[model samples]
Target: MTDIRLFQGPELLDHAVALHSVYVDAFCAPPWNEDAEQAIEFLGSLRVAVRRPGFTAALAFGGREVVGFATAWTTLAPFPTDRCYPRAAAGLGPERTVDWLCGAREIDELAVRPQAHGTGLAADLLEAVAEDAPDGRSWLLTSLRSPRAMSFYRGQGWTQATHPSPDGEGIVVFLGPRHPAGALAAQPL
Candidate 1:
């Protein structure tokens, strides 16, 4: 039997090792094809990210062994000066980006081990992180190249904020339900 647990920032910090292990196992395959270095870097990033306000995480375990996990945090205004944010804003448009995404919950990561793929753990983890979003706003970015992943998000009611880019190398942003950006859900591809 599997168990799902909701964790606040502090608890996430406490279970960092388990979280990192599950993350590496889940994302190092297929579409992600991440290296050990990338996994280590993700752990480093999580260390800082959990400190952010409104950070939340959900961990799935099968008798003490983590099988899946999800993490998210509220986006702040002055909007993250990150490289990806700027590019995302370009695809999503500055108005919708700022009005709906700023101060919203951004799902930074969600992964489930290959052995558990057929199960519904991913959806449960997603709901755990998003259900309590402070502003009832949530969003995430996934590669359009991965049809399975995109299908899963759509199945969960997430609307694509950007269409498949002509270059075919860009990430697709998804806006959760009730977000103002959802109105632009059908913007031209």
Candidate 2:
């Protein structure tokens, strides 16, 4: 059996750190060559505001351990991600316009411990996040080079944005809704 917990207040801080560690472990350096230690610190620092509205951490428990987790938050008219500028630029380059500024849900991290994979833990965490999204739409950007991540997202019914993100290597944007009308399509993965 499995259970999920949505954190708030001081508990939000501890769980946020745990989720960051999981993210750094799962995402790795990949095509960007991110340093693992740095990634952990960078993402962990985001806990400051995640204590507020929209941000949340969902942990999937397998007996005494946390087997899977997710970290995400909502974006409104002004955009909360600007605060993540320094961190985002580390891997994603310049802000180049916060496309989800008008309002959208952004998933920063989702991870499941290797020992707990294939138990529907990740999907369970995602479902909980999706349910509480600012709205039903969650938008995220990923390295088009990571087929594993992209394929998993696609399997969950996330569609690539028609418009490729504005970047040198071109990160693919996956919108959880109907592909955003005419946003631009991605090359086949």
Candidate 3:
């Protein structure tokens, strides 16, 4: 059986190395094709992310070895413009972006070692980070290139709020099942 632990604030840095290992194992191949530099960059970003308001993380351990992990934090109002935030904002438009995502819990990362693919560890980790989301509102952005990931989130009842054009080469946003905007997500833009 796998043991999962939830950590909040900078204290999560205690397992940084192990989490980095899991990240590389989960993302450094095939569809993701990430590299050592990217993993190191993630570690640096994680240091900053842990300091964000309402930051939370979950680590899954299999006999002391980290097999999966997830990170999340409360999104603040005024909506950020960094990274993929613009993509999400552009997709949802300013009003819906503020209403649905500004104060929601945003999942930043969810990675499970390849060996743990079918063990339900990912779902557990996701739930652990999101369990205490404010007002049960949570959201995430994922790449449209990863069909398996899209399918997994959809199976977990996350509603895709963005649909990419036919080329399908961009990111998509998802609202948690309990989010108030989930029903409104299906409405025409």
Highest-lDDT candidate: 3
The 0-to-1 C-alpha lDDT of every candidate, in the order given, reads 0.84, 0.61, 0.91
Clashing pairs in 1: none
User: Which window of ten consecutive residues has the lowest lDDT sum in model 2?
Assistant: 88-97
1 against 2, candidate with superior TM-score: 1
lDDT of 1 by residue, 54-83 (tens): 888989899988899999998998788685
TM-score, structure 1 vs. true: 0.93
Model 3: lowest-lDDT 10 consecutive positions: 180-189
* TM-score of every prediction relative to native: 0.93, 0.71, 0.97
Query: Per-residue alpha-carbon lDDT of model 3 for 1-189, expressed as tens digits?
Result: 999988989988999999999999988987888999999999999999999998999999999888899999999989999999999999999999999998899999999999999889999998898878889899999997789999999999999998867365799999998888898886435
Which lDDT tens digits does candidate 2 get at residues 43-148? Answer: 5556554765577768887775667787667655444455443333343233432543235666766778766667678777877776655546676666656666
- Model 3 segments more than 4 A misplaced: 187-189
Best of the candidates, TM-score: 3
Quote the RMSD, in angstroms, for model 3. 1.4
TM-score quality measure for candidate 2: 0.71
Of candidates 2 and 1, the better by lDDT: 1
